[model samples]
Target chain A: MRLFISFILCVISIAKVQADSFVVDKVYHPYVLPNEQEFEWRLFSRQTDEGNKLAQHIAYGFALSERVMFEAYILGERNENDSDDYGLKSYEAEVRWMLTEQGELWADWGALFELEKQHDSNDWEATAALLFEKEIGKTSLTMNFFMVYEWGDNSRESMKNEFRLQYRYRFLPQLQPAIELYTGHNYLGIGPAFMGIQRFDRQKQLKWEMGFIVGFNGNNKDNALRVAIEYEF
Target chain B: MFKWKVNITSCLLLFSCAVFAQRPEFVLEIKDHLFYPAEIHIPKNKKVKLVIYNYDATPEEFDSFDLNREKVIFPHRKSIIFIGPLPEGRYSFFGEYHPNTAKGVVIVDDTTTVNQPLEESSHVD
Candidate 1:
């Protein structure tokens, strides 16, 4: 009986730290397609005074209806402790619902719900975000406010909040330059981002984005580099 | 001097006529994130107005890279958009939020029939 009780305690303790261990995937857009499918891959790397972290993610996305879209992502990560060892980290799913059309009001709006399950640990997290977009001529801005709650046998009982912002200048149909900012508890980052799209035909297209952020506040990394590529058919 | 006066008057009248002419209009409806009449036919070489009504409780973005136009239609609301005196061809559009299901096309051709759904003609007699 004592051995079983100790085993239970161990499991609960592992679950707690796992809930808060995942990396943040911060780039987002306010548009949703009515009937489209996509396969996307993203690479995120961070360098701090303490250590370096790298994460890889693959996702499949499809429109559920005219205003709703769904996506699933498989994530892997490598940290200083793991060195070159990178393996399955977590599985995440999300639903995005567009709330307003572009130019229909002062700003466009959308909402997102996400759930993440960590591998080999009894840990999970749920997140919700409100997304906003606005455009004036060649300039556009987007913002996302996120609320995350983690739960499990050992998870913290507090809610975590985050905010991300991006501003872009459309220089051409396929290329744009942007600035991004992120803020969270004890975390602040600002960076320059560049993105472009290539349409191969009426039905196929490719998009790429790259960003470099410098941490500006406490307990945050000094810099991080993020990149994402998506293919739609 | 008499010929010049006649020419000036004709030009003024033509300008007024063009200014007063109204473009044809069509109604597109969105429900459950799908565009009604997935295919639309309109007269070629004429500007037209599109009145889109969204019946869903969520917003969707109407995007058409081919037409170089995009608009967000709020749920339970209506939006108006204008398209050009385009050449005969097919212009495809989709909901950016629900791209997989909200797909459609606008077919502009000279042979578009009068019986098709279109706004009242604004041609000057």
Candidate 2:
């Protein structure tokens, strides 16, 4: 565990050296492992008429119970038009709770709680999210509703709500094509996403997701791409 | 402090009660990344306990998007999951760690006489 922590720290420091635009992480399911550890890395790039931005996030997580998972993330971002240097922007702690067992209700549900602190400023943000997932035949739908509160220096203190929707077709066990939509106060994005899982052995597996988004309105970023890789052990 | 203690005590009692509740048990075995008895039939609208034993040296994640259930079974270990009182239908599951071969289903039947054979009486034939 100590070695894993060190690795996470090292990756985060390296990722901060360069990055800019921001993209929201997408969810495909709402299941948490029981008594296992997971490591995840996500890279996102956003392109607009003005400039391009890139960001990197590294997280270390563990399943505390069958229904609960806890994680910490290091976030870094940089803009293409700005200096070529990127530094750590913030730190985040998150907890995910699986609210109901699969097939136990009309719809499977979960929730997420997160707290983030910015590095250069005293700004802190708290987010609460509801996660819903349902499977019908070969298709699965997942949605997230998020409410955030930011405070302190340059803090908006006001609540900001966001919604994300994903519809995926399970074409194969290793490949699933998806469509994603993200909507917020002044931003709207629609994109194509793909997810897959590869089993290396009985004890370990690699899961990945990648997507590209095009902003629909003038206030939104013109283009964005997000990629995430997760390793479970 | 008094309120906190009472809350904790209540939680413990509830947990113990749940643990002691008796439910019909079924076993699913994982060998070579394949599930034996790939289809399980249980009466509809009744909760049941499923005990999964992974005989393989490697761990496997039992995933059923249709069932909304997922659990990681460690090598040579057993895990128990309770699923319930569901409508009549077929719920499919697979081992996430070995999706190619580990697949199974849960069939909830509403018919009570489904598992029992009817007795036929012959008089003069």
Candidate 3:
């Protein structure tokens, strides 16, 4: 446990050295059940020196097979300062692949791929990510390493990377408390998150999550709030 | 780019086919929201298929924290899940919708014979 904590601190230190773009989003897990289907909505709001920003996503996803799932999302954003700028921002398609059976390996493994296009412009972005999860007793640790490439007429072609980590303690079937960390080019944030699920008959369940994050970059007063709800059937 | 896409697609198809190939099969039945047999014995360290038939008018989700498996069996329908290749131990599972009455355990042991049918118990407490 000491070694694990040291490793986490080392990673966080490295991440903070060059961190920049703050991303407030839900952490993805590495499990995919066969024939599972879900509809999800996510809201993220951030307050920074520039202004306040809000983004929303609605997505529908289904498993293609035991190990693979596909999802599509409609994304919208509003600049609180610019009242008229609220509208659709982008469309995204994502694929998640479960690489290892849940306890078959020392740690579970998965991957994610995403392609996004701007609603009214030629801007596009593509991302590939590796997902890892390890369970120690009732606590679970998950991490994501992402590589992104952006290109198009409206944006400069560039490549970027991001890392996210979540450590969760499972106290009950319906509730779990977690600590999450996210790092990117110009931002580093850590926060507390809570998630729960309510199961219903006929293969239906509702899952909800919320988190509040504060930026750690020097002289930057940034805060973000994110929430998500998912219904699976 | 096109060639890369083709290669990835082909690899995924091959992997999917390999995963769906032959494996040891077992059946569990859910009636009146209770799991039949109450306990099942299987060989340890081997992947196996579990086909659950739900006879209740309402659906039930087979949930297990120990085995890390969760699946919903629809009313009057069957659902399939693959479990194990795990170490020898007792893994408990319960019906999410009827947690009070629908419960069972999977006993993974080397000495125990696999798939020995047991009389279905009428009640679980």
Best by TM-score: 3
Model 2: how far residue A55 lies from native, Å:
0.8
TM-score of the candidate numbered 1? 0.64
Q: Compose the digit string of candidate 2's lDDT tens values, residues A1-233.
A: 69945843443333233222232566635778786677999998878778878888999999888789999999998877586668898999999998987654556899999999998999998889889887665677888877777788887666666667788997765798999977665556789999888766654778899999887665645788999999987
Estimate, for each residue in A73-120, the C-alpha lDDT of model 3 and write its tens digit.
999999866878989999999999999866546688999999999999
lDDT by residue (A1-233, candidate 1, tens digit) is 69945843453333333333333356566667666789999998878776888899999999898679899999998886567678898899999998865444557799999998988788888999889876654567887877789887666666776667788887755888999876665456678998888866434679888888887655655688999999987
**Candidate 1 lDDT tens digits, B14-39:** 99997657557777888888999798
DockQ per candidate: 0.04, 0.23, 0.15
Candidate 3 lDDT over residue span B1-125, tens digit each:
99999999999999999766546667799998899979987788777777788888887888986776777666777776677776888989999779889999999888445453333442222
Worst 10 residues of 3 chain B by lDDT: B116-125
Instruction: Please identify model 3 stretches exceeding 4 Å from their true place.
Output: A1-20, B1-36, B40-61, B65-68, B71-92, B95-102, B106-125
Maximum-DockQ candidate: 2
Candidate 3's docking class is incorrect
True contacts kept of 1: 0.00
Give the candidate order by descending TM-score.
Answer: 3, 2, 1
The model with the greater TM-score, 2 or 3, is 3
